[model samples]
Target: MHDDPRLEELVKQVRASRKYSAISEALVRRIGAAELCKRATLQDAVKATKKTLHQIAGLYLANAHPPYDAWLRQIIQAPDDTARRAVLRSIMNHHTSTRERLPILDAFYARVLADLGPVRSVLDLACGLNPLSLPWMPLAAGATYHAVDIYEDLAGFLRAALAALGVAGKAEARDVITDCPTDAADVALLLKALPCLEQLDKAAGAAILDTINARCIVVSFPTRTVGGRQVGMRENYAARFAAMIADRPWRVERIEFVGELAFRLTR
Candidate 1:
């Protein structure tokens, strides 16, 4: 597909848009190629690809150019963990998905990670600003975290933030659907990520779950729309999640919060 001049032009057009310029080129190319297969014309493919990009990522970011440098300076200058958490909370509010979880942040990690004793490593996929919640997780001393997202800038910010928080890990801009991370970890976090992944590929949720190398995987879904309307998303997503894991042998446990539904799969 890369050899096709039409597909190449489609990717260039999509990336030329200011709104999508920072997205992972791998993701843009992947979505653009798929759109080309379905659309009748290059213009149509570009339009469809942009729409999908907005749904999967653009809508979540309140600020396209967040002051990561300033945030890092604040984190490093802060006197203690409380001060660092305050700065992290402010940064997280910039993402709609993470903002919605603020109300439940205190108990969210505790409940989901409670059973897993002394987590030494984590793999956070489609991570967004979720890694900022590291201060609240029950991590062992010198725990390592690996986070991945499609936005290059976000991944860069996360990489620096991880260092500032004194955690050892790496973050990268990756198209998780096309190239899911294979690194082994004690726990893998797919928090509210399946729905977004499925938006790109119907089988993405199951594919990632099957391929991720972790002893336990934590998956979550938003129970409300971005507009804050409750339309039985909890029930809908729960049923879908059940179907995804029904054939697997991993034991499953369900947990529900104010605006999210989560499931923990242990192998």
Candidate 2:
């Protein structure tokens, strides 16, 4: 796709920004190619690409390039699981999405994922620091966890954090919208991800739901905006999610928390 000189140049320009440099090349190319098609010139495409990137990801991060190496070292040197969980929570607080979920972190996973008994494997797509909540989840012995995100640095940090926690899984930097993972798993977690994904492509939500290979999928949406405004988002997202899965044969169960709304779809 980058074969076109214009597209290649667009990708370079978009990634040139320190804020977007760590995003996967696949995602950069995907959005850049689309922008190149719509915009009249390479500069226009580059500007549009950065705007889209900020909407989909940058806005959620408190810092574009977090101190992942330092966080990793903190996790590695923690005295026990309790200490590690504290470090993980601190790291998660840097992202708006995860920070909001912190209030209910202790019960969020247990209640939402309980129906899928004995979770042995999981696929977390567009995962930010949510994977750090592994301590709160109930997993079977030797369970494998697979998580993917567009940020290369964050993905690397998650990979090392998982290893440090003695969990069995791999975290990778992937543009799931373009390259969805096909690995079969007991459950797939799309926590507060669909809305952000739709910012890039309107059909991304349905596309991801259709492609993920899992027996159960737990999808969540924020009930309030980042600024703590309640604007009927709950009702809006509930209806939107209903429409998104209206054609499927899966059984859906709705779960609501203080600031988050979730649905469990079982096939």
Candidate 3:
């Protein structure tokens, strides 16, 4: 933290924004001057709580995907007016709960860690701003972790987060659909980041899904509903994903749909 005037300015801006009052309050409470001092060198408590905050942020948005979806649709079709940027930023600022992410992570750990011997590597796909799976690094023990994402900001964040957590990993900005490296791993985790929506084109998504054939694949997606309507306005992607893998050597061991997302852990 080290008394960053920049963060101070961000806090001020967040508080001053009328639309971001709730987030402003939460952000202010989460980082005080003293906490900021400790955050710089990656103090134990700050690191741990920031880790938790990261999870909270993901679940927060995952829960809001439904309303967020409607908001996005309206913005996309809003005639490209001056209000578009404001609307999009507001939608992006929406948050998710950390409580929800833990349960899903716990379940994933339970299933994957079972009888996992000599597990020494991981390939994480579409790692977002927080790299939700970074918390599992220690548990991964002697493994080398590699993460890829389309967002350079997120990839950089993953590098920083892992460094702060005292874990080693490599992260790169690459299209998950086009730049999957030749290297393989004992496990591949795709935490709610299956590029299905981004692709939009069924053929492209199918190709992306086809390339992944790790010993284990953890696929998660926004569930069927958020504010009563499906998050993606459709639930067919789950079936489509299944169809893509039907003839592969892998087998779907479990499929759990929670909140606005679903988790599929297959082997």
Worst 10 residues of 1 by lDDT: 1-10
Each model's lDDT comes to 0.91, 0.92, 0.50
* Clashing residue pairs in candidate 2 (N, C-alpha, C atoms within 3 angstroms): none
Off by over 4 Å in 3: 1-103, 130-132, 136-138, 195-200, 224-235, 260-267
Q: Give candidate 1's error at residue 182 in angstroms.
A: 1.1
Where does candidate 2 stray beyond 4 Å? 1-3
Measured with C-alpha atoms, the lDDT of residue 105 in candidate 1 is 96
lDDT string for model 3 (1-267, tens) is 535655555455434433333332333434433355555443443444344333433233443123533653555564653455444334434433223354455454555445545557777775543343444333457567787754344455556545544467787766554455557777676755554324323465456555765666666665543334555523566676767777766666645535424444445
**How many collisions between residues are there in candidate 1?**
0
Which has the higher TM-score value, candidate number 2 or candidate number 3? Answer: 2
1-267 per-residue lDDT for model 1 (tens digits): 666689888888988888898899999998988888899989999999999999999889897667788887988898987888898899899898899999999999999999788899999999999999999898899999999999888889889889988899999999999899998999999998899999989999999999999999999999999999999999999999898889998999999899999899999
